[model samples]
Target: MEKRFISLIRFRVAKAQYLNMGLKFKKLLISFFSVFIILASFGLGNYFGKSQCKVCPPEEIDFSLFWEAYHNLQEKFVDKEKLDIQKMIYGAISGMVKSLEDPYTVFLKPEESKRFIEDVTGTFEGVGMEIGIRKGQLQVIAPLEGTPAQRVGLRAGDKILEINGTSTVDMIVEEAVNLIRGPKDTEVTLTILREGWEKPKEFKIVRDIVEVPSLKWEVKRPASGYPDIAYIKLYQFSEKASFDFSKAAIEIMESPCKKIILDLRNNPGGYLEVAQDISGWFLERGEIVVIEDFGGKKEQKIYKAQGPSQFLDYPIVILINAGSASGSEILAGALRDNRGILLIGEKSFGKGSVQELEKLKEGSSLKITVARWLTPKGELIADKGLEPDIEVEMTEEDYEAGRDPQLDKAIEVIKNL
Candidate 1:
């Protein structure tokens, strides 16, 4: 976008320079016509002199694919019972996103849209659960700590079979999330079947305003017992990820610890650069953390550590659950491949696709799936996720008992190392 604006300015300056040059009446007429042509051609960018989406009048919107979607919904869509025109509108919007095949480009109804915008603004209220659909079931990917979901014993691998008696078997993740989350003090009933639980369990949880804690750090004293392990929990690879990670790493280094536990259990990735920057801390001067193969060309990224790796000699036990996705998976995979850390927990979420969000006219945007990222060992973490050196499961009973078997196991593993 910045390059586009600069290019536009350069084009205008060149045109002005051409006008300033004294010319005959005939040349002036030609320049006037040239200026008219250039003004009419409101090009965003040009590749080898070919225009990028030639800007036409607003009347040309009839030919737009969005218009076709609206027409299709009005005429051909079936089911009159509980049929909502707004739902059709939302579906049409979703169609635009799906066309790009970007999984992170989510479509939301009016209320959901509002919530998303609010969340992006860095504040919101609700149970604060990162939800997703897996194997045609509404799954609890992760519940933010201190939120109602986690407070009420919502585990990451728990399959939400029903929400308020309404079966969420085939429901969209967005719809299920909305159904599960509500205002503060509001109660939501969830029927869940945890990974190892034999019987389905039900929980009625009261909602609260969930402020997501982005960072968590704990210094374990007594080198004899826990090896003076420093634990850091990175929830997401968001805008603040790099800064937050640096702060946590620096703080952990301040403590006298021989082992580090980087907990990335339920982190649904945000920005790729965050992953790259964080990985750079552990990786040496020149090492390919991840590579992007986009058909004709392959882009290789060698992340170099800027600061001193304080815990390089120390054993690093990284925790990952089924919810660790995209950026988080990249870091985990990198460390695992490089043999710098031992990965503990279950298989990751496997969303190792890179997305490019293109801003369209108006307030809308188009997020397109650009390329698939591979770990340093050239392993694809897309549909096939990264396997853990130690696979573990969390049960409903374990949650109710106020025990984290995975974290406990990680502590034990580090102790042995």
Candidate 2:
């Protein structure tokens, strides 16, 4: 009986010992996997950290100050609830773009980018005037003829002091544009300082749905016995400008007047291809119309006339002024260089830099100046505008009295031609 009881006790002790060994083995396996999982997770985090930091050179650029400022603003700003991280990012980008000091190179926020698209598509509501920053002042590049701006006598080279009573002292070009544009029939007042005026004049203009027509033509009816001349005014190089120009050219061809006077006085440019197309009407195919200089980094692009010449020897006289720019300047420069046509008026608006629009994330856009415009004669039209063969100045008196001496002089020149 004693031997049986001892055997039972021995078996119970062996079973407890086996259970303890199995538990220890299971704990050891769990410990090993936990360490392995921790090591794997740290390795993955390190790999991703290096990948993200690869974009910025840590050795050369220390973003400590920038981060410090950002953190300080978050900690100290009184209106913490009003702080917009997205707007702060946009402002940072705008500041970076502004550091370039090029007025044409602009960073547009999403809303501003939407308006810019409307501006490019020529389907916006505003006074029909092209505005630009010139000599640190907001200036009117050109006002479309028969538009609200021109009807109110907005001249190119007019320095804008205020828009809608808001001082434009430190206003960006796009901001001023936004203030000037509104729903149709809304009024916007502009305080403009003319060249010869002692005081700035306030001109209240009603905004409208600005529709820019490319070309307008009529037979010039001069007093009594003047030579028959066809008058063609190119307002802008908008969409379908080439087709409209073709139709106008056909009408001019069918007219009795062989001599044509191209009025590019207040034409602020549009499409670059449209300029080339219009130049094709007076230049032979393969003739150089304009040159695109990419700062010698790439081959300078030479734009040549692709279409046939419609008025090669028709003795065309082009009228220009301070308002003539971009495609207008290109056409005037091309016709004068390739066809020996004469230009008569003030120097053109020197907006010759080529801009390319790049769309970014979240419907935002960036417009950067990519290249400069060079005439066929290799004249840089950036700051040095195209000089007319005959320099005719339109004085303030001419404006007040509604006299167009520029057109009159062009008429006189065409008669001699």
TM-score of each: 0.69, 0.84
Task: Give the TM-score comparing model 1 with the true structure, all chains together.
Answer: 0.69
lDDT of 2 at 410: 86
lDDT of 1 by residue, 36-124 (tens): 77866644233324443456445535656766766776677685564586556567677666565444555555566555555666665
lDDT of each: 0.74, 0.89
Q: Please, what are the lDDT tens digits per residue for candidate 2 over residues 1-417?
A: 899889999888999999999999999999999999999999999778878883545567787987898999999999998779999999888998988888899998888888888877658888989999887789999988778998998889999999888998866788889899999999999999989789999999999988777888999866667668999999998888899989988988888888899999889998899999888889999999999999978999999998778788788999988999999999999999887898999999988999899998899999999999999999999877889899999987888898999999988888877
**Candidate 1: residue pairs that collide:** none
Off by over 4 Å in 1: 1-114, 165-170, 196-201, 221-227, 295-307, 356-367, 395-397
Q: Look at candidate 2 and tell me the lDDT of residue 58.
A: 57
TM-score of 2: 0.84
Clashes of each: 0, 0
Model 2: CA > 4 A from native:
1-60, 77-82, 221-227
Which candidate has the highest TM-score of all? 2
